[model samples]
Target chain A: MLKNRTKIKVKGLNQERAINNLSKTIRIYNFSRKEHNISEFEVDYNNSKHIKKMLEGQGLEVVSLKSRGPAFFIRDFFKRGGLIAGVIFVLIFYILQYSFILKIEVWGGEASQCNLVKNFIEDNLDSKLKHNISTEELEILVRNNFDFVSSVSVAFVGQSIVVNLNPSLLPDEMGTGFSPLVSEYDGMITEINLIQGTLNCSVGDIVQKGDVLVYPYVTDSSGKVYEVEPKADITAQVWLSGQEIHYDYRILTYRTGKSKVQSQVLLGGLVIYSKTPDILFEDYECEVYTKQLTKNLLLPFKLKKTIYYEIETEEIIEPFEEVKEEIISKARQKALIFSDKNDIIIDEKYTLSEGGGCHIVDYVVTVSKNIGG
Target chain B: MFNFFNEIKNKASGIDYNLLNEYNIINLSGKLLYVEGHQGVTIINSDMVAFKIKKGRVVVEGKELVLSELTSNTLLLQGVIIKVEIF
Candidate 1:
């Protein structure tokens, strides 16, 4: 059976001596590689060690001996099949790891809150797939596990499973009484409109705290208007004057003519390339370059290249009064958005003080409205 | 001399160039010859089997021999190179 076995090259042995030492029926075979010198022979099982010792005595190195398996099988195993097998093994291993939630990415959440919930879920919930646990059971487990969570969905993604928890809903914006747009803080009424209710007070009326500017009940033109299902509760936001201390530190920039160059490298759809190598001069003060590389074969990875011209920034100090007026303008813009009304009337405007290491302008304004005084 | 080398090489089987250059001359006992470049001298004989070069010279180590080509760079010996040595 071993007569036609693949030959192993035995180095450092004389052919005549080796042939004499072996039985007459045994054939000595010679093969050479760039790496090793080999001599192979089909000897009786009893004489295997003897031949090995003989080769060793002659100082010939025996690297490896191949006896079983077809030659083509071993050859193909080394060539293409080796890489394929290794890839398959790695894929299986990753699938197993993902079968257990090795990683979880939470979106639609603030950074701090996301981290808090992540820690909570990781510490409290049992994230394993038990034999008795169904999808419903897992959802119940997660909902019962977390206090802030209202609903949960547990599902298998690829090899691993994921549990997505939706937090509980906030309280209704229209609370107990009639749905009214009340003043968030103490303020005089700004503008008023009896859209769906009666007017509690007219325009230019000076109203105090909790004064209802508009009522919920209304009468129609035909003198046969039905009573509004909502009660006659009144709600209005007073445009109260607020003194806000604001600090503004001004920065002035001076253009510089000098420029620098850098090099960048990109690979595999993502431009991990950040090294910019050369400086380009242009007459414009700012430059924008947009380059897009396809990432993951579908979506685009956008690289916004903004070249900031060399500029020297200088700090410009403004007097207290000038900055104060600018602060009031910004404050009024913010108030308009916050109140959703525009009838702003300045009742009192003044600057408290300034320059104690804190640069701030303080002022107050009062608004008049047609509401219950 | 050219014919001598050509004839001996033709007679020997598996006489590749690697083995031919590795041959060393042990004894130059019989013939006193001049060493010139190729085809300067020639050896003609029939009893010899093979030839081997020893220490940069062709040594006639076989049972009987004849010499023809004698040059400083190349020589021809019509005989078997039984053994070879460097020194």
Candidate 2:
């Protein structure tokens, strides 16, 4: 049985001691780990008395034996510093997160304005700064400089920044305290509603210039029954005819342009010039440019750019009227995109328009539409 | 010397004399000493014995003084005998 004894672990003695006495029935008890190895050594005394004489012959220093017991694993004990270091690591990790960003709150009159204020706070005051700053001071700095922000309140909770700002609160421009929306473009009226004011134009009635679509009424809706003295500004849409001109020039050349070989590495929305290789041009002139593609991890990969090179080659062929037809088709497509952007519904077919010196054809287009007044 | 032998004979006769005398070969200094049934060998350091079997003709060879106890199966040799050339 292993008891309260210490094990003197002789590092160099374990190897020879293991193979020396294989038959000796003895145990080397290691009290440190509470373990032991047992063996037996034979002493044949009945056959020859000389064996007994040799048993008491010489003396040699025996190495300390280890404890031979079943409970050998009790020696695995924790050191004092291990527990202390574990607690200290946890404490430091918690302090770092709590002492930096505790709380962040943003307030703006409009949600979009609040979002903008949040982004500004994140960019400027979210991270750890090597300075001792007060919440009141930051609030004063924000409120004084920003014209769009009417007021701002800043407070610190633990390690958080609580910021409240008025983003929707606009300064009163007129004494009436109402902002009006006028007609952005001239168009014919399709419908009208008197949501907040007396509408000037009725159904099928056309209105023009500076018509109010919604406003505060000076009188009630029931009182204006007989003599209509315009008590409210009216929002009306006036129809107008508008013309849009579009020019589309498509040089129908073969895909043979060769771009110059150029490579630029893009990192964090910034381009870094890395390498540029020359283009290989055969009998046909070609252009090739290579751009260095990079991942978010800032590793660069190869990217190839190709441009078809075209050269003027004279051929003994009869000229056909195919270029004019292709020009008209390209012009119509360009004119449609232009008309759609202006909210003008096209009614008439596209025809040729005046072009200066360029071979590009111009198409005249007209559209009629109703727009908000 | 006469008084010493008489004293030894009186002491030997006085005890319950077990006159069991045996002899064995001793390989000492490369010389084999043979003993008859009368020359009984007494091993001083009997624990210094090396071999077990002691009967018949035995051979022993070593560098150090290897002592062996003579039994009915083997013989005892006590000396720095280099080799035992059995005849």
Candidate 3:
């Protein structure tokens, strides 16, 4: 048996002393939830306020001071009137919310028509939400409202209502019979994947464009031929070729306006006066003019006037292997235009000729692709 | 000293003196100790708690010692109890 007691929790340092003091002051019982610097205990209901004030005087925080008994529960129930009212409101709202159809869904209708029907349902949802309209009544109302719609069914499914409708539609035309699968390009058949069809041709067979590979009819074990829509995947090795002619070397000229001039006088096949090498441009197109200084052919005495124009030259030389690879990649890209997305290249060979001041490259890529209808 | 009073009461009431000689009935199970005969909590701390009995005091030594239940006659001490001493 337990009497109604006031449960108190105090927060401060030296909680041990606080608990000991409360035990001595009042008859404290049911000590629990003890931690470092925090204590919880219960005292007599009449002494709760006095104990709380006594602990406060000692600078300890009275964290919680509450009563634990039937009397306290009754007192709290009347004190928190707004809380009880809000709880009741929520319970009633939950029940009413689930009972009403919040949304209407159309299963067999075009997207725009579904939206139109939904809008129509929403406009009249006030009465439906209030339980004034039933599912059967709503179905008949929808059938009579829309002349194009014939069969209508409105069913309550959980929180929403589903409407099944069939609108009047015109009959469709007859479909054409299935045709035999044919090759789109000329190649040698390498592999054939047949899911459902009659094989008209086998592997290793050479086929041209529009050659039939699978027939539209399949024969049963009893020899009864039935027309079928053939389903198959055919693979054939077709060669795609691309060629490019490139010059063996490329020449580039730089744009430079700087020039330098040099004049020299020579005697007896020996240099008498000349400009130093450092004064001349490293690379230039030089123009030279020579005049006979002495009229002696054996001595060869001459005055030489030279003009050097400064020019900046930048040369980029790619390795032969890299250039060959670049050409092959470009050729492969060009050949890919003639192939389909599902084609897988099995073999690739390129013929390269590097002579006669030009490079001739020819690429042939053999790929397997689906060709049957 | 209280044994003389207990002997007189036992002779007059036909009660066994051995049961009354047991000052504090300590029942220790794992982390919980129930002291049936406790006067009051003398000292309570996270590491230790001391209770005053009839003639002596009982000190509980452990980590995170808590007075889970407390009354004038019974005390429930909860924590990792290492030892208990009656002085």
Candidate 4:
């Protein structure tokens, strides 16, 4: 075979004598002497064995013999085809899995509308192969086909296709039709600047929720009523209430600083190797992390590592003052969510009641804001 | 007498300055020796190597001498050279 060509190293106390003897018997194609003791000779593989035996017979040691050529590799590959074939098969399988879509997701739409969009996507994809459709093309098709969608985005995460849809604003919601400006909160109308409609509530007048701050119907001096869209800047001092309960006594679970880690190899969801015998902790938490060959390929083999932490529970008693302050702060934050950035807080009052090992805090905040919606 | 010998030799061989300089030897710090216009190897050994030149022979004596490279017309020797002689 073409692989049989190789080199042999001859070593002895007197390498020069060996080279002189070998050159006379067989042609020394190429030779190099190192350290005046060891010498390497390049010879045919068939001749190498014979040369080694002859050199040994002559009291010269053959240190090492190795075959070098393309034929040797070809022979080795044929001898171990199963191993190489498995590696190639795995690489090809991973590539093919990621090339196709396995899942589709549609978010940011009503349930019925989402289902409609999903069906539309499925119908369009059903006629063609999975990999043939591009994500950008799909986003454009969805946006063009659905008139109600204002913005649509599509992305591919591994094998899943995620679509995001933003619904368009309705005409009434855009504030185009004639409508009354009603107070959204019960408050005293401190300021009112009417732009188009007649102001129903005057400044310093108390108004209830649903009360119209600006009326779209305007009666002129001649008793002629003209309807127009109500536009106004109505500021009011609104009182907002927020309540929260803080537990004075609580049960807390914490790790006991003892943890156990176990590793296992899973093939097709079946555990092939596991060193752990059994879990011993009665109250414990387990976190399992898995690493696979590829995300989209869903390869049969994966490495799973699980960490178990032993936990203990204890009863904790909190101070009443601390609990009350915490609840009041949370209540204030809740009230602020309803107020705008330009709104000013006029007054704040926190009332606390103790019952059932808990402190119930009710916070009332007065703020000046535009109460018209 | 020397001028008479030089005239006779130059006339007999028709030697020019460039041709005479062809058999050149360059010694670099006594470590490397470069020889131009070498003919063939007469002897090769661990301590010495001899090559044939146009007029006579060039002998290089060294320790652990090795022919690092050998071509049809030129050869390279590497080792600790102690002596170089031309005869």
Candidate 5:
């Protein structure tokens, strides 16, 4: 067993003489006397009583005799095992909490698909739970096992595992049975090439939305009608229009370089402490940012900072030509979203008008694209 | 008498005290004092401490002087050492 130690304060006017006498009587493990006449030293706990008696006999004061070191702690721990038992229980509880899987959640799949994934994981990876499981390995395994799963990700929320999967695109064989190729937009067919079905609309034929371009039903030579899913390559000249309206005079908010910052701490969704004050600026924008204290540990404590910036609005008038150009550019960009790379822009038209201090611009773009479905 | 013993010990160990400077007293920024190759500590008080070397005695005067460590021949003292006297 390690020897127990104690620190005793020796109070006297002559610290040197006291230290000298104490050193002669009892072994001083360590001693320090700083600026004051009082000095403190550590001695063996067993010899403390004799040292105290010796010091008192010499008309000196020995105060604050306290046991130190792990020896006393070990003795107390064995005497009352409740503290040690509680600590052991807490350690076991945390170990179990982090080790076992409490819940398994699956996302981004049909009910049946999710159930299949869950069952697969439980059957294949259940035995490996005794050891640490790598989420990257699990994700790769899941993605490789399911053909429909385009991507998979595995995440751990405390003891629960969440699996997210993305489904792949459907195959061509899953198309509607005996469905004809219909026009997706109102346009005139500019070119047509039929693979299996009879062409219903010829080139330069005006067609409406939902009109069939290629008929899936064909009449055989024996007066028998058969059905087949239509396949075709039909190009149509489609007219697309977009409009944008911009004000010639507008009020814009500008930062005035005046701002105030406030800090706060939230515990369990409640504000525990804050140094924030009520906003004094009438026209101001507030930006709120929050930082979590313990990440990935399920702690409900966070520090929040909010900054308010005072703003001033100014009215400015824009030139008609500049506003018109901006509106036309915006309208053209909007129309381009509907056209594809191979599509040809056959014609473009722009119209501009002014009313109510606003410049209104309308644009029409004619594109030749494959609009068959 | 101490020097005579040290000379005999150095000879037996094949060491030269003159070249080696047997006793080394280093003051670190007036905060710590490192004494190497010391014989022993003779007096220790709150204000001063004295160590016996081969040639003479080294007395360190300071406030709240603490003998941080003591080994067979080396001593480390830490405090606000104001003065160091050798006699």
Candidate 6:
């Protein structure tokens, strides 16, 4: 209701008298605001312009006259036609374009590869709406299609779905076309499931690391070489080794009779208060523990107890024959934890030696793992 | 208690209580003042405002006083209204 009313302000020596005069002329309106000797009021749209001219004729400066209602728009609609048309056109275009992916954009890569990817995506697109398609799935599909594609990312940029590609360096735009599968570890071939490559080794063939298990190009019976990106699954018996040393003698530290326990209240991990008593021991170690003191979730307060234990050190030596089995068992345990969980453990062996107050053990673990990349 | 005494005073003065809603004043928590049956605005300022009522002048004293609404016979006064006196 207030927005539809016309607002007017008049400046004069006596604003109160001016309001009285206006009220006498248009007796049905109400005054809204008055400041700095200027009074403002709302009048009907039909009387606004006439009232402004009437105030001016009375020698009162009409400060502002704003008539806001449906009548003003109807009188001046044709003057703003071009500006309104441009705004409407932009609104319509924005609504139609941003809701769908306009086109695929490749940021970086070989031109041939990018074109090839664009063609593939255009042919396989299920939907063009931004929410209907997943950019991560597109990235994975592009990476899978080309063996030389090092990295790729697909995201919606403005109205277009942009695909940023960083393909690995190849021989040419036509591409070397194929990649050979080589053994990543020295092992004997245990399994070979050739999906799409010529296998050079069979089961039980001993192979070394860097040995090519599949060739890049394949020869047909007509002796014509057709290059293809190689793909296969190979498993091998890989030997992994871990070495660890155990000492027969060690330095032992014990706490003396002197000790001190200091209490502290910690609020949100900050020390709010701590009982005073500086450390008296020259060489001491501190053991800290905390207890929850606040039951309310809003106040996170804990009571921390730091116990200072005065310590003294001494060296203890023992004969190697006394703890022989224990040292070997410890060495084996430490070495086994370093082995891979995915590897199928077949057999293990260890070599033991004695040196300066320590037992040194080297362990070799044999396992079956997928080695060819 | 104030409203009861004012009613008694108005009755003793022989004024009509509900006739045309004339010479009426409503104070809301000393923050807003509404007066009807006003003849004219005699004086207006941040601290004080006076209006011509039927029998005498009604003066409103406060801080940051403002006449929010005005008509031929009614007016709405707003701001921190400290006191309203009849002269």
Could you say which candidate leads in lDDT?
Answer: 5
Instruction: Give the per-residue lDDT digits (tens) of candidate 2, residues A1-373.
Output: 3333223232222322231221122222211211233212222222223322222232222234333223443433234567668878999988776667655677664777666666666666644531355677777677655646767888776776778886434423212434444444444555554434445455554445566544433354545212222233233332222233333332333434544545455544455445655545443454555655655455655455444454544333322234556666666666565344545444535444455423445554545443343
lDDT of 6: 0.75
lDDT-wise, the better of 1 and 2 is 1
Query: Candidate 4 docking: what grade?
Result: incorrect
The C-alpha local distance difference test score for the whole of candidate 1 amounts to 0.47
Model 4 Cα shift for residue A119 (angstroms): 50
TM-score sort, best first: 5, 4, 6, 3, 1, 2
> Which residue runs of candidate 5 sit more than 4 Å off their true CA positions?
A1-186, A197-230, A254-269, A275-283, A287-312, A322-326, B1-87
Candidate 4 residue-wise lDDT, B1-87, digit = tens? 565434544775556644554466656566667676677655556676677788888888877666655443566666688899999
In model 6 chain A, the worst 10-residue window by lDDT is: A24-33
Which candidate would rank higher by TM-score, 5 or 6?
5
Residue B79, model 6: Cα distance from true site in angstroms:
99
Which lDDT tens digits does candidate 5 get at residues A1-373?
Answer: 2668887887766554555555554556555553265666677887877877877866768767878778888778878878888989999989976787867788999999999998888776744353577789889888878867889999887777899999876555333357778898778898888776778889999898899888776667965455666788899989887888887778988989888889988888899888977778879998999999766566578899999999999998877776566679998888777788988999999888878888777888999989886
Superposed model 3: Cα runs more than 4 Å off: A1-6, A9-65, A68-75, A89-103, A119-126, A143-153, A156-160, A164-373, B1-87
Show model 4 residue runs off by greater than 4 Å. A1-176, A252-314, B1-87
lDDT of every model, 2 decimals = 0.47, 0.43, 0.73, 0.75, 0.78, 0.75
Leading candidate by TM-score: 5
Query: A16 in model 2: Cα distance from truth in Å?
Result: 99
Q: Give, for candidate 5 chain A, the lowest lDDT window spanning 10 residues.
A: A168-177
Q: In model 5, how large is the Cα lDDT of residue A320?
A: 71
Identify the superior model by TM-score, candidate 2 or candidate 3. Answer: 3
Best by DockQ: 3
With candidate 3 superimposed using the best TM-score fit, by how many Å does residue A61's alpha carbon deviate from the native? 16
Q: Candidate 6: where are CA atoms >4 Å away?
A: A1-179, A200-205, A222-227, A251-326, A333-342, B1-87
Query: lDDT tens string, model 6, A1-373?
Result: 4335567777776554555455445532445336555766667776675787777766689888777666666556656888779888999988877889777877787788778888888877899877788888998888877766778888888877788888776543224646688988888998988866678899999998889999877667967565666667899888776666666678888999798999999999899999957888888998999999979789889999999989988888876677767766666676567456787989988898877777777777788888866
Docking class of 2: incorrect
Q: Which model is ahead, 3 or 6, in terms of lDDT?
A: 6
